[model samples]
Target: MKRFVVRLLINSVALWLTTLIVAGVSVESYDADDTLATVLTYLLVGLIFGVVNAVIGNFIRIVAFPIYLLTLGLIALVVNALLLLLVAWISELIGFGLSVDGFWWGVLGAIVLGLLSWLIGVLLRPIMGRSR
Candidate 1:
Protein backbone atom coordinates (compact mmCIF):
# COMPACT_ATOMS: atom_id res chain seq x y z
CA MET A 1 0.00 0.00 0.00
CA LYS A 2 2.79 2.43 0.80
CA ARG A 3 4.59 1.55 -2.38
CA PHE A 4 1.38 2.03 -4.33
CA VAL A 5 0.96 5.49 -2.88
CA VAL A 6 4.49 6.40 -3.81
CA ARG A 7 3.92 5.13 -7.33
CA LEU A 8 0.72 7.13 -7.57
CA LEU A 9 2.51 10.25 -6.37
CA ILE A 10 5.18 9.78 -9.00
CA ASN A 11 2.57 9.25 -11.69
CA SER A 12 0.68 12.32 -10.50
CA VAL A 13 3.81 14.36 -10.86
CA ALA A 14 4.27 12.94 -14.33
CA LEU A 15 0.69 13.76 -15.25
CA TRP A 16 1.09 17.28 -13.97
CA LEU A 17 4.28 17.68 -15.94
CA THR A 18 2.47 16.40 -19.02
CA THR A 19 0.11 19.34 -18.87
CA LEU A 20 3.01 21.74 -18.84
CA ILE A 21 4.65 20.24 -21.92
CA VAL A 22 1.71 19.14 -24.02
CA ALA A 23 -0.76 21.48 -25.60
CA GLY A 24 -4.34 20.72 -26.64
CA VAL A 25 -4.36 18.29 -23.77
CA SER A 26 -7.32 17.15 -21.72
CA VAL A 27 -6.38 15.10 -18.71
CA GLU A 28 -8.35 14.29 -15.61
CA SER A 29 -6.99 17.60 -14.39
CA TYR A 30 -8.95 20.03 -12.40
CA ASP A 31 -8.75 23.75 -12.92
CA ALA A 32 -5.84 25.60 -11.35
CA ASP A 33 -8.30 27.86 -9.64
CA ASP A 34 -8.83 25.38 -6.89
CA THR A 35 -5.42 24.37 -5.66
CA LEU A 36 -6.62 21.71 -3.27
CA ALA A 37 -8.96 20.16 -5.79
CA THR A 38 -6.27 20.14 -8.43
CA VAL A 39 -3.89 18.38 -6.08
CA LEU A 40 -6.52 15.82 -5.17
CA THR A 41 -7.37 15.31 -8.82
CA TYR A 42 -3.73 14.69 -9.62
CA LEU A 43 -3.55 12.06 -6.89
CA LEU A 44 -6.76 10.42 -8.12
CA VAL A 45 -5.65 10.45 -11.72
CA GLY A 46 -2.28 9.13 -10.71
CA LEU A 47 -3.92 6.30 -8.82
CA ILE A 48 -5.90 5.39 -11.91
CA PHE A 49 -2.83 5.68 -14.10
CA GLY A 50 -0.75 3.49 -11.84
CA VAL A 51 -3.42 0.80 -11.57
CA VAL A 52 -4.13 0.77 -15.29
CA ASN A 53 -0.50 0.62 -16.16
CA ALA A 54 0.10 -2.20 -13.76
CA VAL A 55 -2.82 -4.28 -15.00
CA ILE A 56 -2.89 -3.56 -18.74
CA GLY A 57 0.68 -2.66 -19.50
CA ASN A 58 2.02 -6.01 -18.37
CA PHE A 59 -0.42 -7.85 -20.60
CA ILE A 60 0.33 -5.56 -23.53
CA ARG A 61 4.05 -6.08 -23.24
CA ILE A 62 3.49 -9.83 -23.11
CA VAL A 63 1.02 -10.06 -26.00
CA ALA A 64 3.18 -7.85 -28.19
CA PHE A 65 6.31 -9.86 -27.71
CA PRO A 66 6.40 -10.61 -31.43
CA ILE A 67 6.20 -6.93 -32.23
CA TYR A 68 8.91 -6.25 -29.72
CA LEU A 69 11.14 -8.80 -31.33
CA LEU A 70 10.35 -7.69 -34.87
CA THR A 71 11.08 -4.07 -34.11
CA LEU A 72 14.11 -4.89 -32.04
CA GLY A 73 12.30 -3.33 -29.07
CA LEU A 74 11.39 -0.06 -30.76
CA ILE A 75 7.81 -1.21 -30.50
CA ALA A 76 8.12 -0.91 -26.76
CA LEU A 77 8.13 2.85 -27.15
CA VAL A 78 4.97 2.69 -29.20
CA VAL A 79 3.40 0.51 -26.58
CA ASN A 80 4.23 3.09 -23.96
CA ALA A 81 2.71 5.82 -26.09
CA LEU A 82 -0.41 3.80 -26.63
CA LEU A 83 -0.73 3.28 -22.91
CA LEU A 84 -0.60 7.01 -22.31
CA LEU A 85 -3.17 7.54 -25.04
CA LEU A 86 -5.34 4.94 -23.42
CA VAL A 87 -4.99 6.84 -20.16
CA ALA A 88 -6.07 10.00 -21.91
CA TRP A 89 -9.10 8.25 -23.37
CA ILE A 90 -10.06 6.93 -20.00
CA SER A 91 -9.58 10.34 -18.47
CA GLU A 92 -11.88 11.91 -21.02
CA LEU A 93 -14.54 9.34 -20.31
CA ILE A 94 -14.21 10.08 -16.62
CA GLY A 95 -14.38 13.85 -17.19
CA PHE A 96 -10.71 14.64 -16.83
CA GLY A 97 -9.50 17.75 -18.64
CA LEU A 98 -6.92 15.74 -20.53
CA SER A 99 -6.77 14.56 -24.12
CA VAL A 100 -4.05 13.53 -26.53
CA ASP A 101 -4.10 15.35 -29.84
CA GLY A 102 -3.33 12.41 -32.12
CA PHE A 103 -1.14 9.38 -32.56
CA TRP A 104 2.06 11.24 -33.34
CA TRP A 105 1.37 13.67 -30.60
CA GLY A 106 0.56 10.86 -28.27
CA VAL A 107 3.84 9.21 -29.16
CA LEU A 108 5.86 12.35 -28.61
CA GLY A 109 3.95 13.39 -25.54
CA ALA A 110 4.28 10.00 -23.96
CA ILE A 111 7.96 9.90 -24.67
CA VAL A 112 8.55 13.28 -23.13
CA LEU A 113 6.20 12.74 -20.25
CA GLY A 114 7.62 9.32 -19.55
CA LEU A 115 11.16 10.55 -19.65
CA LEU A 116 10.29 13.35 -17.30
CA SER A 117 8.67 10.97 -14.89
CA TRP A 118 11.64 8.66 -15.06
CA LEU A 119 14.03 11.48 -14.38
CA ILE A 120 12.02 12.66 -11.43
CA GLY A 121 11.75 9.17 -10.11
CA VAL A 122 15.46 8.65 -10.41
CA LEU A 123 16.14 11.87 -8.54
CA LEU A 124 13.73 10.87 -5.85
CA ARG A 125 15.28 7.46 -5.55
CA PRO A 126 17.81 8.54 -2.95
CA ILE A 127 15.05 9.68 -0.68
CA MET A 128 12.27 7.29 -1.53
CA GLY A 129 13.88 4.13 -2.88
CA ARG A 130 16.65 2.64 -4.89
CA SER A 131 14.73 -0.14 -6.52
CA ARG A 132 11.21 -1.40 -7.10
Candidate 2:
Protein backbone atom coordinates (compact mmCIF):
# COMPACT_ATOMS: atom_id res chain seq x y z
CA MET A 1 0.00 0.00 0.00
CA LYS A 2 2.73 2.40 0.96
CA ARG A 3 4.74 1.41 -2.07
CA PHE A 4 1.76 1.96 -4.32
CA VAL A 5 1.23 5.43 -2.90
CA VAL A 6 4.89 6.23 -3.38
CA ARG A 7 4.79 5.17 -7.00
CA LEU A 8 1.66 7.20 -7.55
CA LEU A 9 3.29 10.29 -6.13
CA ILE A 10 6.39 9.67 -8.18
CA ASN A 11 4.32 9.42 -11.32
CA SER A 12 2.45 12.60 -10.45
CA VAL A 13 5.69 14.44 -9.99
CA ALA A 14 6.98 13.05 -13.27
CA LEU A 15 3.82 14.10 -15.08
CA TRP A 16 3.98 17.55 -13.53
CA LEU A 17 7.59 17.88 -14.61
CA THR A 18 6.71 16.73 -18.07
CA THR A 19 4.12 19.50 -18.32
CA LEU A 20 6.80 22.01 -17.45
CA ILE A 21 9.38 20.59 -19.85
CA VAL A 22 7.19 19.33 -22.65
CA ALA A 23 5.15 22.04 -24.28
CA GLY A 24 2.88 19.68 -26.17
CA VAL A 25 1.79 17.58 -23.25
CA SER A 26 -0.31 19.16 -20.52
CA VAL A 27 -3.01 18.44 -17.97
CA GLU A 28 -6.20 20.40 -17.59
CA SER A 29 -7.35 21.24 -14.11
CA TYR A 30 -10.96 20.37 -13.38
CA ASP A 31 -11.34 23.75 -11.77
CA ALA A 32 -9.27 26.34 -13.56
CA ASP A 33 -9.00 28.75 -10.66
CA ASP A 34 -8.40 26.26 -7.90
CA THR A 35 -4.80 25.26 -7.21
CA LEU A 36 -5.81 22.25 -5.16
CA ALA A 37 -8.06 21.03 -7.94
CA THR A 38 -5.20 21.34 -10.38
CA VAL A 39 -2.84 19.32 -8.19
CA LEU A 40 -5.43 16.67 -7.55
CA THR A 41 -6.18 16.46 -11.25
CA TYR A 42 -2.53 15.78 -11.92
CA LEU A 43 -2.50 13.09 -9.26
CA LEU A 44 -5.65 11.55 -10.64
CA VAL A 45 -4.25 11.57 -14.15
CA GLY A 46 -1.09 9.97 -12.80
CA LEU A 47 -3.15 7.24 -11.22
CA ILE A 48 -4.97 6.66 -14.50
CA PHE A 49 -1.64 6.54 -16.30
CA GLY A 50 -0.25 3.96 -13.84
CA VAL A 51 -3.32 1.79 -14.17
CA VAL A 52 -3.35 2.04 -17.95
CA ASN A 53 0.31 1.17 -18.17
CA ALA A 54 0.04 -1.75 -15.80
CA VAL A 55 -2.94 -3.30 -17.56
CA ILE A 56 -3.12 -2.45 -21.24
CA GLY A 57 0.52 -1.50 -21.53
CA ASN A 58 1.66 -4.86 -20.19
CA PHE A 59 -0.62 -6.76 -22.52
CA ILE A 60 0.62 -4.81 -25.50
CA ARG A 61 4.23 -5.29 -24.50
CA ILE A 62 3.75 -9.01 -24.19
CA VAL A 63 2.14 -9.18 -27.61
CA ALA A 64 4.84 -7.05 -29.13
CA PHE A 65 7.75 -9.01 -27.75
CA PRO A 66 8.89 -9.88 -31.26
CA ILE A 67 9.00 -6.23 -32.24
CA TYR A 68 10.91 -5.41 -29.09
CA LEU A 69 13.53 -7.98 -30.00
CA LEU A 70 13.66 -6.80 -33.60
CA THR A 71 14.12 -3.18 -32.60
CA LEU A 72 16.57 -4.04 -29.85
CA GLY A 73 14.11 -2.40 -27.38
CA LEU A 74 13.85 0.90 -29.25
CA ILE A 75 10.22 0.04 -29.86
CA ALA A 76 9.74 0.71 -26.17
CA LEU A 77 9.70 4.41 -26.95
CA VAL A 78 6.78 3.99 -29.32
CA VAL A 79 5.01 1.70 -26.91
CA ASN A 80 5.36 4.20 -24.10
CA ALA A 81 4.18 7.02 -26.32
CA LEU A 82 1.12 5.05 -27.32
CA LEU A 83 0.45 4.30 -23.67
CA LEU A 84 0.62 8.00 -22.85
CA LEU A 85 -1.74 8.79 -25.68
CA LEU A 86 -4.13 6.17 -24.41
CA VAL A 87 -4.03 7.76 -20.98
CA ALA A 88 -4.79 11.13 -22.50
CA TRP A 89 -7.72 9.70 -24.40
CA ILE A 90 -9.13 8.02 -21.32
CA SER A 91 -8.74 11.20 -19.31
CA GLU A 92 -10.46 13.28 -21.96
CA LEU A 93 -13.38 10.91 -22.02
CA ILE A 94 -13.79 11.29 -18.27
CA GLY A 95 -13.90 15.12 -18.54
CA PHE A 96 -10.56 16.39 -17.17
CA GLY A 97 -7.13 14.97 -17.93
CA LEU A 98 -4.03 15.09 -20.11
CA SER A 99 -3.98 16.59 -23.59
CA VAL A 100 -1.27 15.60 -26.03
CA ASP A 101 -0.71 17.78 -29.09
CA GLY A 102 0.29 15.06 -31.54
CA PHE A 103 2.14 11.81 -32.09
CA TRP A 104 5.70 13.12 -32.04
CA TRP A 105 4.99 15.31 -29.08
CA GLY A 106 3.57 12.33 -27.27
CA VAL A 107 6.76 10.42 -28.05
CA LEU A 108 9.00 13.17 -26.71
CA GLY A 109 6.81 13.62 -23.64
CA ALA A 110 6.86 9.90 -22.96
CA ILE A 111 10.65 9.82 -23.18
CA VAL A 112 11.03 12.67 -20.72
CA LEU A 113 8.30 11.34 -18.44
CA GLY A 114 10.01 7.94 -18.32
CA LEU A 115 13.39 9.46 -17.44
CA LEU A 116 11.89 11.72 -14.79
CA SER A 117 9.88 8.94 -13.17
CA TRP A 118 12.90 6.61 -13.17
CA LEU A 119 15.17 9.23 -11.60
CA ILE A 120 12.61 10.14 -8.97
CA GLY A 121 11.91 6.50 -8.17
CA VAL A 122 15.62 5.75 -7.75
CA LEU A 123 16.04 8.75 -5.47
CA LEU A 124 13.04 7.79 -3.37
CA ARG A 125 13.86 4.08 -3.12
CA PRO A 126 16.34 4.58 -0.30
CA ILE A 127 13.92 6.61 1.73
CA MET A 128 11.03 4.32 0.88
CA GLY A 129 13.16 1.30 1.94
CA ARG A 130 12.78 -0.45 -1.43
CA SER A 131 9.72 -1.90 -3.15
CA ARG A 132 8.39 -5.34 -2.36
The TM-score of predicted model 2 comes to: 0.96
Q: What is the C-alpha RMSD of each candidate to the true structure, in Å?
A: 1.9, 1.0
Best by TM-score: 2
Candidate 2 per-residue lDDT over residues 1-132, each given as its tens digit: 888899999999999999999999999998989999999999999999999999999999999999999999999999999999999999999999899999999999999999999999989998678535
What are the Cα lDDT values of the candidates?
0.77, 0.95
**Which ten contiguous residues of candidate 2 have the minimum total lDDT?**
123-132
How would you encode candidate 1's per-residue C-alpha lDDT over 43-128 as one tens digit per residue? 87777677778899999988988988999999877887888778777777877645788888887777877788798788777767
TM-score of each: 0.86, 0.96
